[model samples]
Target: MSDRDTRHKASMEKLKARVEEKIASANEQRGLIIVNTGNGKGKTTAAWGTVTRALGYGYKVGVVQFIKGLWECGERNRLEEDANLELAIMATGFTWDTQNRQADTDACQEVWKEAERMLADPETYLVVLDEITYMLKFGYLDIETVKQALENRPLEQTVIITGRNAHRELVAMADTVTEMQEVRHAFNNGLQARRGIDF
Candidate 1:
């Protein structure tokens, strides 16, 4: 082999050995708390990907839309057809748009009940709390309440929390935290959000 190809093969072989070692050392398996947060987009979209993955395996899945209100969601439209999925969307579109603190808080609490149910369901393999960080950010949902619920969830049931500005406590406890940084968006360039692509 050429010198360049020989060096690349050795480097890849070393990387494979390291990865196999780490995989072998991970003996125990348990539920995970995955946080998707940042100012960028795709937070909910990534969680939806996980939702579909779980459903494809015939596992029961639950979703609670803490901030997403009455709107056309293409992902939701497709996922709704599955019998293993349970979705509860909030009534208020956006707290900023509604400008009603009491009403928004009320809706948050109501939907939180559904989230609590999903968290407590042992049969549910995965639960997606989409856009829930907003409720926590707005102080509509208590951080302690969420923390306690997460702490008490089934040992083998994973949960995904997606939205910007995830609380420190949530970040601390999460097994995986993905922050989507906004580099540049087309909306900033005077282009409207496309239906299938943006949503």
Candidate 2:
């Protein structure tokens, strides 16, 4: 082999050994609290990806959409058809569109009741709280109540929270936190949101 090729093979072998060692050492099996946040797109999309992945393993999933009301979402439509998945779209509309603070708060409370029931259930392996940060930021739901529900969930039930500007407490409590930084977006150039891509 060429000298450059030999060096590359050696480097890859070393990296592979390190990765295998780490994987072997990771023996713990428990639910994780994963957070996807930041001023960027794809937060809910990424969470849905995880939901589908878990479904592939025959896991039961529950989804609660906080601020996206009863809109037509492709993922929602597909996942709701699965016998193992339960979806709840609990919002009148976006906060700006609703313009009714009391009504929004009431709706959020009802959503939380459903979410808490899912959290308490051991059969549900994954729960996705899409756009929940908006509710927390707007004081529509109590942070302490949310935290308690999360902390008290079944040991093997994972939860995913997605939205921009996730609360600091939620960040600190998360097992894995991914921030989607916005480098560029089509919307900035005045392109309308595409059906399958944007939603």
Candidate 3:
């Protein structure tokens, strides 16, 4: 065998040998904050998948959608009916679309307060801050408040933040950071969002 092949084989053997010993000594890892950031679709959808999976495990999930107002995200419609989830929506729509900066900030603060409540609630195992980057982007909400809320959230609670351009500090603090790179998009071809696919 080549020297590189022999070295790779030896490394694999070492890794295999250590796995059993590590598993025997491992303790339950603490709950974490997961951030999904990028300029692509599916960030919120991916988080919704996590929300559903966590619900299946009987976890109490809280969802606070920051920029998207009362619009229908089918997941929210369905999940809100389930007793395992708490859903809060920022009924003021997007900043540019809404055309009222002060009103948008007020709406953001209202939803943010609810998010803060969920962060404090020990019963909530997972909290999804959907599209919250827009809140920070528009200055509707302070980023430090959001950061402190996440940092000091009930140690048992896992928070998931999803959006494009998540703050650098927030990404640094998150236990897991997933950045979805957009290679191709149907939107480029003038395709609009479809129900059950985009909301």
Q: Highest TM-score, which number?
A: 1
lDDT of 3 by residue, 1-199 (tens): 9999999999999998899789988777777989999988789899999999999999999999877757778887777788989988898876668899988888889989999999999999999999998889878888889988987888889999999999888898998999999998898889997888787
Who is ahead in TM-score, 2 or 3? 2
Residue 78 Cα positional deviation in candidate 3, in Å, after optimal superposition: 2.0
What TM-scores do the predictions have? 0.98, 0.97, 0.87
What lDDT would each prediction earn against the true structure?
0.93, 0.92, 0.89
Best of the candidates, lDDT: 1
Backbone clash numbers for all candidates listed:
0, 0, 0
Find the 10 residues in a row with the least total lDDT in model 3.
Answer: 66-75
Q: Which runs of model 3 end up more than 4 angstroms from their true locations?
A: 1-28
TM-score of 3: 0.87
